[model samples]
Target: MIKNSYIPIPVKVDKIRFETEDKLIKTFDLVFMDKEEEKAFRYYPGQFAELSILGKGESPIGIASSPTESGFLRFTVMKVGVVTTALHNFDEGAIMGVRGPLGNWYPIEEMKGKNVVIVGGGFAFTTLRSLLIYMLDKKNRKNYGEITCIYGARTPGLLCYRDELKEWEKRKDMSLYQCIDWKFGAEGPIEEAAVEGWEPINLKEPSKTKIKKDIKKFTAFVPQLVSAVKPGAKDSYAIVCGPPIMIKFTIPVLTELGFPPERIINSLENRMKCGIGKCGRCNIGPKYVCKDGPVFSLKELEKLPKEY
Candidate 1:
């Protein structure tokens, strides 16, 4: 009974939580303004929606909250463009437009019963957070193998979902390795100082928090954490999302650890005008990122042209 794919439904920003210290990245909690529409909006964990602010523009943003957390949807936006800036400026209770659950999701069926390795950095961590949460839910955890996550940011302050990450760290069901590229006065990640074994990764000045052991003091590149963890690739799928440099290095390591191309998944993004397949900007070879992807297993990706 839902109508057109291009028509956006009006929603109200339920709340806004700044995920980072600089406030560049924010998590907006959203709910449909219409109760009927809200009850009907259903999206998978790795899917995305076209978020619009009318004159500003409509942009494709991934759904950050898992379906397991059902009452509302969440989108984490980094202020990088006119549309995103508009989203960040909106106050709680502000009305906005959304059109989606568009784009293919992470192959949850393929991931079932398999170990999962989630790797991400910067703002690209959004969808990965969704996938992780869905997999870790009590009803779903038994359906999967061991879950490991390697997440990083440039500095201590830039990591997303720290509160959830902290709670995830406390759970015995999953393993979380959090690191940073560097802190103050470092040329590069401290792990660069040694070719083998993990360095202390300590901060120059200790954290003021009196928890006896603080999470922020840890320092290393995202790849370095992957190297140290060296997750078993025999029955595992590695889902990686990050900037070009990080993805370039991380893939080789995952391969070296024994994961085949088929078992590695990559989330791709391209310039999107219309979230539906109508507009050609999101096209890559024969596929449209907004429709066919945003999530692709490496085997599926290898068959496509390299232009993307």
Candidate 2:
């Protein structure tokens, strides 16, 4: 829905929130400079846009806000490089530029009436948050069946949207599974395992006990958590976004749970650049991650060159 692929639309950073205790990740809430651009710049979960700053270059970031949230766009960024660090230094009301709503989205329509499993790790949870919020919206909730979300980070402090994660855990419509790295497990000191409102489960136990309905926190890698959750594959689809290693391992767990390749989805945002297909940086075989994807089913990715 972008009016021009080459030009970045003017926007203002209305608010900025640091997402992690390390202060390396920040979520920018942007408001389009013009009301018309605000309305015209429609986007969905899993799509990304290029954020621009004069002389600093552009960075393609996933849209973290759901469409159900109007009048603004949210991008959760990690301050890893020049552009992102500049963004982190910026304060509220800082004017900037945005260049999309580009790339395909999660199979929202196809997911209608099917149980949805969302798996994510670390900072990759941004767009997954978008998809979850969109599906959980009242208007869209009826179209989807049960929703299950399994998310993990190295520590509780590294998790994004901490407040929202707590709220989601209380929601009856969806099941929320949170995990920290194994170092935070019961084997660790009692003080470390006692994160407020979290209960650690011993990984040596059966998968059933590891994922009991009342137990939401686990000390394991994202893939191990997915296997423990063991969500049903009947009329279900699993959407996963994470580090490459997490995806590599999680795919097998989903397949073992009976989810076909087509039913296992992923987002390749780490490979995205330019936000339009003109730049070849995102190419994997004949497909452009910025154009053809950033979103793809395992079946589709299997056909690609695996360069990603």
- lDDT at 304 for candidate 1? 95
TM-score against native, each model: 0.89, 0.93
True-structure lDDT of candidate 2: 0.87
How far is each candidate from the true structure, as Cα RMSD in Å? 5.3, 3.0
Off by over 4 Å in 2: 1-3, 182-210, 270-272
lDDT of 2 by residue, 1-308 (tens): 55557788999999998899878899999999999988888888889899999789889899999999998899999997888988999999999999988899999988899999999999999899999999999999999998999999888888899999999999999999998874434464333253655565545532554456688986677887788788899999999999999999899889989999999999996555577788678788899888999899999999988687
- Tell me how many residue pairs clash in candidate 1: 0
| Candidate 1 vs. true structure, TM-score | 0.89
List lDDT for all candidates, in order: 0.82, 0.87
lDDT of 1 by residue, 1-308 (tens): 67788788998899999999888999999988888897778788678999989888898889999999977889999999999998999999999999987888887888899999999988899999999999988899998999988888877678898898779889888888776766455565554342222234323312221212323224566765676667899789999998878888888879888999999999989989788898888887899998889888888888999877
